[model samples]
Target: MGEFLRMRRSQLQLADVGLRDFGERRRVPGLRRDELAQLAGVGLSYYTRLEQGLSLNASAEVLDALARALDLDEVERAHLHDLARASRRTGTRRRPAPERAGETTKQLLAAFGDAPAIVLGRRSDVLAWTRTGHALFAGHLDPHIPDQPDQRPNTARLVFLDAHTRDLYVEDWPKKARDVVGKLRLAAGQHPDDPRLAALIGELTMKSPEFASMWSEHRVRKWDLATYRMHHPVVGRMQLNLQTLNVPQEEGQRIVVVTAEAGTGSAAALRLLAQAGTSSGAGSARQAARTARRP
Candidate 1:
């Protein structure tokens, strides 16, 4: 919480909050702790303690006032509450049970059919995907890899470390990368004790300098819907709309469906890709049957 507050504070200026400097040399950027405390109707020392992590028992009213003073949006306010709740917890950190796509989730994926869709866990792990989802998003990887927990693809890892994924976004790769980092930031605040999540963050920080830099910025974002321009090696270029739907039954699981406008070239490309995926799947099944019969 202290880190988050400090980062937000640094982003503001006197002019932003109706304060004027009298040409005094100020060492710190943005509003000072005293200024912010005054704005939030709290004592300077009390606000300082909160920002220093010395006070963890702040009430919701206080948090809301501080959030308002900082000009946080709805998602940012929710994230602040999440961080506060996490800090108030006691006892040892517990590892959450591994997340999986339930039967209902699988059915939902099947319902999407040739439309590209994937199920993602809290940490953005690929739990399951439709055939065309695999084809459109990661045709270079093994189609069955998501079935193996140990080999599952993490979207965050792919965006930062995988060369193919970097090329997948024909433009706005940085925006996509920032979105991944921001979501991970929100996840980290919500699940501060999840060891696997901590490990994933550590690995990315060490492996990718860009990831490390963005992670340090302390940005938080929630994915809803977005459009991306993509260039697939097999299907060519496409402008696809991505929508994320949360699975209420399975906490932290979300269904991401990608689509292209009807009658557009991108939609036609998606159909061609789906057909190729179907043909390849059938050919593989035939090869497997032949091998079994020979043996």
Candidate 2:
């Protein structure tokens, strides 16, 4: 709660990006605390207390008005609203993790040929993957094992907790973590009834001190344009562009496709991955035939 208030303050600062974004280049003093108070239709001292999170009981109407007064963009406005909701449950009991992506979804991942694809559950759990995808993106471990209620290798958990994450990402690891937290924050707003999201928040707050500390900051990130520099063992270094595909056929699922620019070493690396995948597919086909004959 203390952190979320501070985050709201940052959003307020962003409203005057010209001055508050950086102090050195400011000509005007930007909005004085009183000016913001006027915009929010609240007292100067009252707004100040709210910004400080001195009270955990801001009404939905006040929050809505404050967001409008601050000129919060859609994303920030939503985040401010979410913090208000979270404050409502400071002492309440929470629920269980939600249903994850299913087997048909996993089969789709397997069919993507050389493309490295991993299906993630809401909290960014790596639910399923293609053998080639695993070989490309996360070659160090097996994917058949399900995440324990607490031990799930969620991208957020892994980025913060796993040492291997640092090696896997070339740059922008912090940005990615921020994106994870930001997206999760947004999800929390949409599914206020979801106990699993609460559990994820609780687990993250407890397990990773960095996450706990960052969660306090309340920074919200919109990942509409998320792209990463993917590092694959077989593909060497491929600049894979990421496109998040929403398939309504699979509820609570998003398929991420990783593609490289054509005619580069990455393309050749992709070919090698596809060839390796073909061999595995062949072996599986033979095994299935043998099992059918056994009956």
Candidate 3:
């Protein structure tokens, strides 16, 4: 990867940007080749050979070592892999995915209707969902809506552009918007070429000033913990702790669970509310699923 990229022979010299310590009183542009090599724990000559395109056969381990030294993130790491594959003239056709959430996760979600549990796809698409999860995650305007891709209440769009979400949250709508935009930014960086994701971003950018402003900040991240107040239809006003668990074996999928303290009216309200639209939701969801599988 290094050798092939080096072969490009760009006019701009880079002996300044990655210097060990700002290249105090230095002459050239970015970090000198040896500096990069030393920082990467690689031999100066060997790294020079890599930079000069004399050697392009560095293994994955070597590439990873370099990436770490340069502070490359998940997206950057994946990008490095792509560069290496392209350099090697290898056609990287990924195996067809046999990947999906297992029965255990589905069961776990079904059992966690204590508040709400929603499973989001890699790009925040509403995938399989629990009953209350749909209502809690998105207002239950209509159970039949999820049947159409256009009708699904995307978490990103809702938090950023929807008037209902803006009005529904009792506090910190800006904070929530930032979090949603930040998560989407992270996903965008991680999956740069995803058409659906690209489309979603384009839509948001065109539609919402808040989203457009937040996205430009380049703060790509995830939501590990979030607590917020909300007005629930089935219940009323409540405070819930939103917990997120990345589903194991399901790459890019997450189970978001909301909870309230036990013995409180909030907890009772949550439980009752979760059951409020469940049975009918399940029937509708099953029907939708069956329809989807039909020819």
Candidate 4:
């Protein structure tokens, strides 16, 4: 929370909030603590304690006022509340049980047929995926890998650590990376007590300088719908729209469905890729059966 407040404060200018420079030659970039306190209609010392992490008992009214003063949007305000709520929890952190896609989710994936669809846990772990989803997203990986809970591929890790994922987004790779980081920030705020999440963050921060740099910005976002241009090793270049659907029964589980508009070249490319994925899956099944018979 302190880091978030400090970063947001540094982004504001004197003219942004109706404050004059007065030629005083300020040392800091944005509004001072006292200035922000005045803007939020709170006591300077109280606000200072809040910003310095000395006070976690701030009321919702006060947080709302601060959010308003900071010109926070809906998502930012929600994230602020999440952070505050997390700060108030007191207990030993527990490692959460591994997440899985339920039966209904699996059935939904099957219903999607040739469409590329993947079920993701709160930490962006690939809980389950259709055959086309595997081909479209991580075809180089073993298609059955998600069956092992301990070895599920994490989207954030793939984006930052895997070369194939980096190459997948041929255009606006940085934008996609930022989107992943932003969603992870929101997840961290929501599950501050999850040890696995903490480890993931630490691993990314230690391994990828770009992840470390973007994570420090404290950007928060929820992925709903977005379009991207991708270069697939097998399918070549195509533009696809990613739609994220939240599971009502399971909290923090989402299904991402990939699609392309009808009659477009990208749509035709997706059809071709789907056919290839089906053929590959069939061949893998046949090979497995042959090996089983030999054994």
- Candidate 3 residue 244 Cα shift, in angstroms, is 1.2
Q: What lDDT tens digits, residue by residue, belong to model 2 across residues 5-26?
A: 4455544554563333444564
> What does the lDDT read for residue 200 in candidate 4?
96
Clashes of each: 0, 0, 7, 0
Better of 2 and 3 by lDDT: 3
Question: Model 2 lDDT vs. the true structure?
Answer: 0.64
Which candidate order results from sorting by TM-score in descending order? 1, 4, 2, 3
Estimate the TM-score of every prediction.
0.92, 0.70, 0.61, 0.92
Error of model 2, residue 73, in angstroms: 2.8
Best by lDDT: 1
Q: Model 4 over residues 44-118: C-alpha lDDT tens digits?
A: 999989888999998999989988888788888888888898888888766666688999899988999989999
lDDT of 2 at 17: 34
Q: Which regions of candidate 2 fall more than 4 Å away from where they truly are?
A: 10-33, 43-64, 68-71, 86-97, 107-111, 147-151, 191-213, 247-252, 275-295
Candidate 4 pairs with clashing backbones: none
- Candidate 1 displacement at residue 242 in angstroms: 0.3
270 Cα displacement, candidate 2 (Å): 3.1
Task: Give a tens-digit lDDT track for model 3, residues 1-295.
Answer: 4532232222123443243364368565445566566667889898777776567687888778776655566655655665555445545434323224468877877877555887777777666577677766665456555556666667888877766777657476777787787678666655555677888999999998878877765554566889888765445566788888999878778988888888876676566565557667545544544453368
Residue 93 accuracy (lDDT) in model 3: 34
Distance from true location, Cα of 125 in model 3, Å: 1.1
Write model 1 residue lDDT over 1-295, tens digit each, in one string.
9999988888888888888879998899888999999989999999999989999999999999999999899999999999999989998767788889999999989999899999999999999999889988887788898889989999999999999999998586998999999999999988888888999999999999999999888889997998899987666678999999998789889999999999997887777767657667645544543443363
**What is the C-alpha local distance difference test score of each model?**
0.88, 0.64, 0.66, 0.86
